[model samples]
Target: MAATAIPSYNPSPRVEPLVQYRPLHPTFGAEATADFATITPDLVDEIKRGLAKYGVLVFRKTGLDDARHVEMSHLFGDLDDVAPFVSGLGQKNRLSSDYLFDVGNVNPDGSVMQPGTMRDLLLKCNYHFHADSAFNPRRAGISLLLAHELPPAHLGGETEFADTRSAYEDLSPDRKEEIKDWVVLNSQLQCRRNANTDKDGILDPLLDTDEFDPMKHRFGKHRLIQLHDPSGRTNLYIAAHAHHVEGMPIEEGQRKLKELLDHAGQPQYTFKVQWKDPGDLVVWDNTCVLHRSVPGGYAGKYKRDLRRTTVHDMGPQAWGLNGVGATWRSGLD
Candidate 1:
């Protein structure tokens, strides 16, 4: 019989530097090194920097409640008041505040929507690719979705993200030259109409064209190629909300939009993220990526609840002479 020697502990040991991010995808997507509770202002600044570099980040096992979710979202930037769109949607049971955007399959009464119904069909509209608040002039920079409730793995409620930045980079020189002068018109009315329209007829009968109003919904016209303010990188900003290229025929513009979307949707530029746990949080750059919810079978059978918070870009010119966040620095160097 041989006796094993026990190792003695040293008075002091070398401490390894903490890893901040782990890469999830080559083009865009990373996982945080620590828990959400340990995320301080400095770490948040680093996360912001990482977000500026990578298009998406996934934080796993963050057991955050509604109030904490809102608190953490504010560290990135000022929260957008999404009350208008969320107010009439549903129950406020899990919502920490009215401003939190509910991105879920659960009904207002904490029940799942039945399959093939109008509400179910409307939820299917999210299957199309789009950036959050793209039609608005005050575009969302980053969007964070926290998984409050998750469905069974077999049910499949994954989210797909396309890196528009990489997609733009992958374009051929000729294609780039052709689209350089193109301008895209993004409108909520156009987006809703496009979603409801199908091969034979409208999928959702409740969709009304008469209710379209510019005053009620946001709309904007932007160049096809968008430059990232922080990184100076060019990204394609086309989305479902984009109606057409200015001055081009409607049919031609739509064809071009579909072509670009198909190109961007390629497997190389797209990442389909599945929720492995209940507390998973996905943070992505809305400015450089288009995302969509995967419509799983029977929303009523599988319950998937999620909360989203958007952070607007805080560029100096963004808070110009009369902006809300800051006052003018007209003569500053």
Candidate 2:
């Protein structure tokens, strides 16, 4: 296979929105106000640009009916089915199985996926920091979560989003230069442990065997902190799946990673939306923005269901900032 020039250091680039978010519905009709497109009036070019730059965004109050959600999500990019690791609602609780991906305490059959004593530790994963599909090389670049249900008190269950693209920018040039070619490992299983912590462990959960181990069986993938090859735009691929620096010591790597993650999740680079009512759909670039839902203490309350769809990433975002890597034409259609 042909290869492009390898970047000696991770380069930095400015970030922008791939699409200019325009309202689908005008405040009023022609009689009252003016006619408008309800689905993103912005051009497809605008959306392509938006997704490349922002990594994720939301189409507010678009009124996606039962079939519309699947239709519209497909338009942005390709669609990816729910991962098998999540809970399936089975026959009785079919909503999650048919549409939404069941996360957290996904005991649809009332049979604990884990043990009874491990429930609290397990559910904490829903509150941890991570991105969708950080484990797969063909991870979803964008994930659209339409808010079908929300909490009654309506506060804690907010979806928290942090823009790593912006966070990476805030670092000094020296700092970025220092780790340009560096790659961070995204261990799929470890991430599952963080989000699916219902097992029996205090820190990052691990496989249960005779001699317990954290790094065993869980090798990592190196993802970049640079550009989205095709669009030639810069971004950050760090998330819950992100483990540590490739060559650094476990202790030092852990410390530096903690600092990066802490800065990335700070209020400044982060945004949270308290989803209320139906007809609200949100999409974000999972590669650039790490997101997690505060599933609320009301998961089984009034029954909130949100259907999510994904677009496959054209290339693994492993080369940071260098403007080097595959292109959408070579990756996304």
Candidate 3:
């Protein structure tokens, strides 16, 4: 009896978590506590799960270098290079890796970008709520943004995100049905125009330029309402990049788009993330959310060096209406 009892020995189970998440908002953003510098397969899987549930994940003080940033981004999906887009602007990528995009107001010489400059004006479009690479043939799925250097505290430069999935759920049944089958044409030029609409004479010089002509560029045609596969919820895909409805008059489509955007961007469905440390990282699913940069007094005074790596959407609707061989073009291409 004793020998038989001794034979059934069991050791205590040991369990360790790869990562943990703290909800930042009631519905959307989360703060992930983990060592992102040393990424593992299990860590990546957990990160993906967090993105699906929260739509945005903020990691503080990850201390990931440019190489590590690109490496970790690859675990999400194929990385999107900014070369094609920046080349058309007649600017060279200051970052060492093509996968790492410069999202801050810093010049190649490590100087602050003065206001009213071409780069500064172009970056103003980021103030509007929009999804990354929405105008590209294959839209962006995940974006990993790291703060390499930040401006002084309380000077602003915070990033804001809108929960489109939750916004869609808030819409009335009739409203949802009205846009259920609608398609929109998304263009980079349209995004710029929308951002500068109120600024008198700001876009005049660039309007007649071939590179800024909406008619000369190809547009990304995508459904206004789409099912976000990861979260298994429908989302409003409208953005500032959306030019007009597929079959409606330009004026009518613009009005409808503005209405939808205004409703979706209400304060109840938005969250703002402040950059506290230089190593702070924020990963967001562009497919289910829209993000914008907040303007602060730090512009032209301090350098905010933010770098981002974008992953191309690999889902069924990744290419939208653009078929295979539809490469990325900034009008010049």
Candidate 4:
């Protein structure tokens, strides 16, 4: 197969480098510095190249409002809307646009969600490491998350990312070959159930009802190991949403999936980004890394108002094994 050709970008003499990157991790993450006001087609290409090299990029105090945030996301690719998921839960849109996902803990009325509530339980799933929209037929490509409002420091609203590409590179050759061609089943319901079980042992009523059965819900089928084309590296695509492996007994497949997830989640292969200011932004490629929101003292006390825009994956593996034209379907829908 021919490599996808990327057009060369040359910045003007005044701004020789469109963006500058400082490595956050030796292997994966980076802090990017760029002039937001000077955004151009050439600059967008440079940012995309940066993302290809560093799976995650942090931009400090971007100072973008909801409108600008959405506008910036368009520079990457087609955006995925949160309306389906929002409406599936029988709730009205909270953000100004469906393109912006309200990942914060605040409700439509601007009140923090109380602990043990259905919404709270559902949000708990964010604590687990997973790629955005992996449960969908077309997985997410690049995700731009901005901190609109943040809790006080040390309250633990930080976001953490796992470097699956590096983790895969470090794996024993035998282990890599063993799972290279394996297919895994990913489901949003399974992720929610696991999050609830791990946190408070609170059985979500929805999970108990037939309407929300994990087994019955639509599962996104993808290879366990895949080539992250942009970086030309093979990465483990496992996540908390990965319910089980295909062509194996349920229990056996689950245990195998857990083993891989545990290996990839080791501290050495992870980086935590602490939200500093309200306007801080983090951009990550979901095709190569797994990310999760860190829970802390800010849980039910303070509001962590974060909004995200997910770009639909345009890579060759975007559809995985699912049929073309398949859309995001949540169990709640």
Candidate 5:
């Protein structure tokens, strides 16, 4: 007698649901609270669109490891190899890949840098408000900062961000017209020197040095204002890296830039994000915002480590930076 063969039955594949996005700020930025494992291709597209609309997107409770972080970064676009910037930070001070930009006060040996140390002094430069990779010809479209470890909220390690789009919108028509045809010259080292150099009859360098040269720094050119394509909005491009304005006197341009910066940083136009938990990822649009690290309780006493990845724009069009033939700027940060 022949026995009937039994058939194997397979259940239907589970569908990935859309994630929820709650606005964090009035003008720009949103918080995405979703399970990382459930993120699908459709959700990734939604996130890209959200980034375009909000200018900043944050993922809470991601708990992403190194591999997951890299995988998540690929959702926006191709990754930029920034290994040159990541190297020399010590073995544990950096990740295995050059793509990760380590931003922290902790040392490679799992220890915090002593206060007033050279590394600690270098971090002081971050106190100045500026966008990541603004000195690069192909500026970063999206910059991700994942909190690996954070000190107590009372310790004061907070990151502040200002909305450039809102600032541009509040500008007077005449002022907008004046800057419409203008361009800014950006220099990273020059900005760093400016912040560290002793001025106003006071010594401020983290380390003393007589050989201060601004001419030897790398520089780039960017529009005085960035016209975003998706939202059809204009955002001021002025940052700490913008040393001077093109086609204008150095002093006058600098004065105007200073004035613009002052106006843009109004309390109403800015918000502070407190990094209280690990695995919280903040993705910001560098083209439309200026961010800086607030002073922590103590550099060495507390463990505050945050890893970053600066993703280059999808080309000149992504940033509305003029034409497709734009060249990459030779700048270091």
Candidate 6:
């Protein structure tokens, strides 16, 4: 057989009549500095529903303290400790990474080699554009990224969340059937990039021995392409980690992956966070959202600081709350 041409994912032609969105309330333009007052009843309810529907919600300018940040996150569920894969330091403990997740923030190849070292890593707003936790079965229920410091660049600190619910609904029935039971290998890579940024060197960017077990480093890979078992929702989890689709050919597999990625990141389905000031907190659903920091920004200015709490649904081997350090099921270790 020759090969199948990659499918295009334009929904404009197949969908019903055109629809548009006007803001619910006069769409108050985002403010410069969001006030961090008490979490209102309306805010909580909207956050819950938005997390379920859009998989992400962006809060601009809410100046909350550490205690309140953790307390508010607790209402959602337990939080996970910052894994070695992330860059956490100082008071910001539970985040996936700490300090600034920006480009120059991480050391050469992307791992933070040491504490308090200025490797010129990228700003936190320069997010890498991927799902929060596709590796675990109980993926991160929601991500709370609060901006205390904005990138000095002043333009691209905003985050883009694709409407994953609609993304899943738009999939062709045939494409849906093709990946019914498939899974993908999920791993974290922060090191091993050659000067060219294309050379693949090792399994992960770093050993990740503290957060992830060196033995289970290669063993924890769950599946090749994920189907949301809990919600019967379809979302792609493959990122820099997914190398192949279990039984699919190398070239063929890559083609399908690219098509999915391109379709997922379309601007029409995404919302960007042009950060106005600190005190902004964003909560998002990991299962139904794909996020990325627009690269090519804040290459060397501004120190981005944000705190995050990872929440997972009840699982037999659920990850414990992120406190002094990360503690998980020894089996997973």
Model number with the top TM-score: 3
Between candidates 2 and 5, the TM-score winner: 5
> lDDT for every model?
0.73, 0.55, 0.88, 0.88, 0.73, 0.48
Worst 10-residue stretch by lDDT in candidate 4? 198-207
**What is candidate 1's lDDT per residue for 189-252, written digit by digit as tens?**
5666666777886535566534442234434666778687766789898888777778999789
**Tens digits of per-residue lDDT for model 5 on 57-155?**
778768887777777777777666655444433334346566777778877677887876666656666887887766765667788889988888898
User: Measured by TM-score, how close is model 1 to the native structure?
Assistant: 0.83
Estimate, for each residue in 1-333, the C-alpha lDDT of model 4 and write its tens digit: 999899999876673587899999988899999878755778778888999999999999877889888887898888999777677767877889999988889988999978898888888889988999888888899999999889998889899999999989999999988998899988988888887773666666655666656787789999989999998999899889998888889889998899988998999999999999988989999989999999999888999999999999988999999988886575743
Cand. 2 TM to true fold:
0.68
Residue-level lDDT of model 6, residues 1-333, one tens digit each, is: 989999987766564312112221121112122234665544555456544444555565566756677667767766655444343332223333332222223334433334223232213212444665544434466667766666665545556666554555667899778866555444333211111133453433332335433224431243333444444555555443333455678568656765765676666556666656677777766655677666445544444555566676433222212222343322243
Which stretch of 10 consecutive residues in model 6 shows the poorest summed lDDT? Answer: 24-33
lDDT of 4: 0.88
| TM-scores vs. true structure, each candidate | 0.83, 0.68, 0.94, 0.93, 0.85, 0.63
The list of candidate 5 runs beyond 4 A from truth reads 1-17, 86-93, 198-212, 317-333
Which consecutive 10 residues in model 5 have the weakest lDDT in total?
Answer: 206-215
Tell me the lDDT of model 3 at 287: 91
Residue 132, model 3: Cα distance from true site in angstroms = 0.4
lDDT of 1 at 283: 87
Please tell me which model should have the higher lDDT, number 2 or number 3: 3
